[model samples]
Target: MHPELYLSYSSAFAIGLLGSTHCLGMCGGISASLSMALPVGRGFRFRQTLLLLAFNFGRIGSYSLIAAGVALLSTQAAGQWAWAGLLLMTLAGVLLIFMGLSMGQWWQGIRYIERAGAPVWRTLSPLTKRFLPVNNAGQALALGSLWGWLPCGLVYSTLGWAALQPTVPSAALTMFFFGLGTLPSMLATGYAAQWIRSIKSHQGVRKISGILLILFGLWTLPIQALLNL
Candidate 1:
């Protein structure tokens, strides 16, 4: 891959790893509930693991799908407007900064961006109920696919970054890797809810993650390139 594309993917995965505290707040409940819903029996751990994996597969699949859709639209717009691509990159950088601030509990302005997605979530939320009380991996998968649409500033921030990719597939892959970064936390949540919760609530970890993300956002901006020119 080109160095820039590699950097984009790496940064996206880092964002997912660093911002997973937000993920815990958003999707961890459902993940834990999936475990609790399953009956304790022989092979209980296996079943729980299967269901969680399925759920996350579906969730990550949805993220890639959304990224593709957004990249499709953005690429078309960029084709017509010379400045559209740059605008998207700038927006992505700003969103990342906002996300970092929110992650650190320094500011919550990203909540407003999340609220912008509420209407979409409202339309999709009811569908999740149909898959509740998940009995099988398929049901869990369906539920998770739906849950992925939940209004979230972290997801939106990453989506903005994904949109700036040159191609739809690249954008989708960006999100796919990002989802992978969150897997450790999501998987651990079902097995060790308290431990995961404590990590989410740890102020020191959050602050360090926030500062790294802020630096990343600044690096993502084109200011340095403009200055060099």
Candidate 2:
């Protein structure tokens, strides 16, 4: 199976970025809340920062596991890797369309599954309560990890794309990068994401990002056609 160049292609560096416009709300909201919820103290800010890093670390770890598992399954799938490319293309196209609609305010359920991860989030979230009136950095970090379990469609879609990679390690790395890519925006929200969120409207962000996703989908189509994927 030829998993070269496009086979294990990186999506905009981090596949997660493509979904940022939509994720701004759910992830953004949670981050803002987490930042505010930190126990008040001179070290609150410092503790909050560590909390964010830890949360994302756990989150990316989970995503990597999922991506690697999928990649292993795909790595061995009947190949020329046609199915892999086809699936990526399909997902890209669907995401582009849905993101486009979502950007225009046509729908809001795109984030529903992100809530499904809430069961885990709920279990982990209460653990954060133990740290309230926030005493130490470790507790804040644990809080972030608990919140990181948040269900996100963007994360799920990116995992699917990574799974399409023929090599499991590449898939894991791809997800790791994707997670890193998202860290900036998410972290910003954690500390001060509200400022950015205030300036830009989700619809505006979605419309613009939606177009980018469509172009990405188009780019994948040619690869699919070449492979007859």
Candidate 3:
């Protein structure tokens, strides 16, 4: 893999991991509830872990699907204009900056993007209730897949970066990596909710994360390459 491309992929992963702090606030309660809903048994811990894993698998799989679709559209656009990647990436960078600002508590701009996705989430959210008291892996999987559609600014921001990739495989891989990055935090939320919440509340942590995210957004700008030259 080219060093530059590898860096982008790493950035996607880092973005997900960094943003998982936000996920703690967004999905932490849901994750805990999901755990409690599991059937009690001798192997409860084992089964709970498996269900959590399945849930995330379904969620991340959905993300990969969206990334692939976006990449396909971007490919078509790229065919029409050689500079499509640059343009798309620039747009994504702006979104990341907004996300950073939101994380830093400097602005509430990302909520607008969340609101835009609310209609779609409203439609999908109802279906998730049907899977309540998840009894099996399949039910857990289905519920997580639906949960992926929940209105989330962090997801949308990382998704824009995923769409900016030049190829479908690369874009899909980007989302997959992002999901991997988020796995730890989500898993921790299931078992260590208080610990995760403490991390989420630390003002210094958010400030540092916001700064890093902003720098990452700047690094993706096409002008950065020009500046390097």
- TM-score list, all predictions: 0.96, 0.73, 0.92
Across 1-229, the per-residue lDDT of candidate 2 in tens digits comes to 3446344445635445656555566566755666787778798887788767766676677667777877777767636555556666566556544544554466655566456666776676667677664444565555545555567666665665575565787788777877777777778878777576863475566566666655655554545365652
Answer with 2 or 3, whichever has the higher lDDT. Answer: 3
Candidate 1: tens digits of C-alpha lDDT, residues 118-137: 99899999998899889999
* CA error at residue 82 for candidate 1, angstroms: 1.7
- Which residue pairs in candidate 3 have backbone atoms (N, alpha carbon, C) closer than 3 angstroms, thus clashing? none
Rank order (by TM-score, best first) = 1, 3, 2
**Native-referenced Cα lDDT, model 3:** 0.83
Off by over 4 Å in 3: 39-41, 224-229
Q: Give the Cα-based TM-score of candidate 1 against the true structure.
A: 0.96
What is each predicted model's overall lDDT from 0 to 1?
0.91, 0.63, 0.83
Error of 1 at 26 (Å): 0.3
> Model 3, range 55-151, lDDT digits (tens) per residue?
8888888888888988899889988997786778787887888888888888879899889889988899989989887888898899888887777
The lowest-lDDT stretch of 10 consecutive residues in candidate 3 is 220-229
